[model samples]
Target: MEQLFFILLALLTLSAALMVVTTRNLLHAAFWLILVFFGIAGFFILLHAEFLAVVQVLIYIGAISTLIIFAIMLTRRIMDPQQPRFNSQWGLVGGLAALLFVVLAAVTTRVAWPTTSATLPAEPIKQLGADFVGVYAVPFEVASVLLVVAMIGAIIIARERG
Candidate 1:
């Protein structure tokens, strides 16, 4: 049952990710990206990392995805269907990406990775909270400020459009 669920979730994630890249409409692509983020949060839940899953949904789905949708809404030209999706150098970039994927696949298959199950710390959530407030407070606050600035900018642009 768990294996089946994992396979299904993996397929859903892969399909959503493909849609995110292939879809021409920026809004549709953003929605697909949200689905991909949800799939990742699902995987984190499956791995017994509830904190990480919640963080994924709150940060990626709630914050980041909302920001992306706002940006898409603000940028009118980005949704123009007449604009070419692929550039002249697409083929060269695609070839390089394919080659890199092949190399990474070969390297991953050749590795003898350990299959041992590791135990989690007794109070990981507490430690994480402490670290966030004590050590990582500056960066975390900076991120919050950045998000606020982006939202204000989006609103300003939208007001102009209106």
Candidate 2:
């Protein structure tokens, strides 16, 4: 069951990611990106990283994707139909992306992952909450501040010019 979930999540993630890159419409690409982010969160859940999965959904899918969609709507003029539909360098970009994927797969397969004798804790939610509010509190606050700043910057950039 877990293996099946993993396979499905992988396929969904890859398909959505491809759609994000290949789609000509900016709005459609942003929607596909949301799917990709959600699929990644599902993958994290399958890996037993519930905290990461929640953060991925909250931060990427909830916040970032919303922001991206808003930006696309606010900057619709840039995506005017008169503009050329396809980038000329797509072939080169695709070749480089494929090469990078092959290299990463080869390296990952060659590396020996670390072994652990301790069993995974049952209450991951409690542990994650403690860690976030204790040791990681400062970074978490900083990230929130960064997100606020980014939102403000986006608003400023998207404001109509006189």
Top lDDT model: 1
Model 1 lDDT at residue 21: 80
Off by over 4 Å in 2: 144-162
**Residue-level lDDT tens digits of model 1 in 1-162:** 999999999999999998998788889999999999999999999998899999999999998999899889977787998887778898898899889999999999999988878787788899888988889999989989998998899778767553
What is the C-alpha local distance difference test score of candidate 1?
0.91
TM-score to true structure, per model:
0.76, 0.82
lDDT measured at residue 53 in model 2 versus the true structure, 0 to 100: 88
The per-model lDDT (C-alpha) reads 0.91, 0.88
Off by over 4 Å in 1: 114-117, 133-162
The CA-based lDDT of model 2 is what? 0.88
For model 2, give the 10-residue run with minimal summed lDDT: 78-87
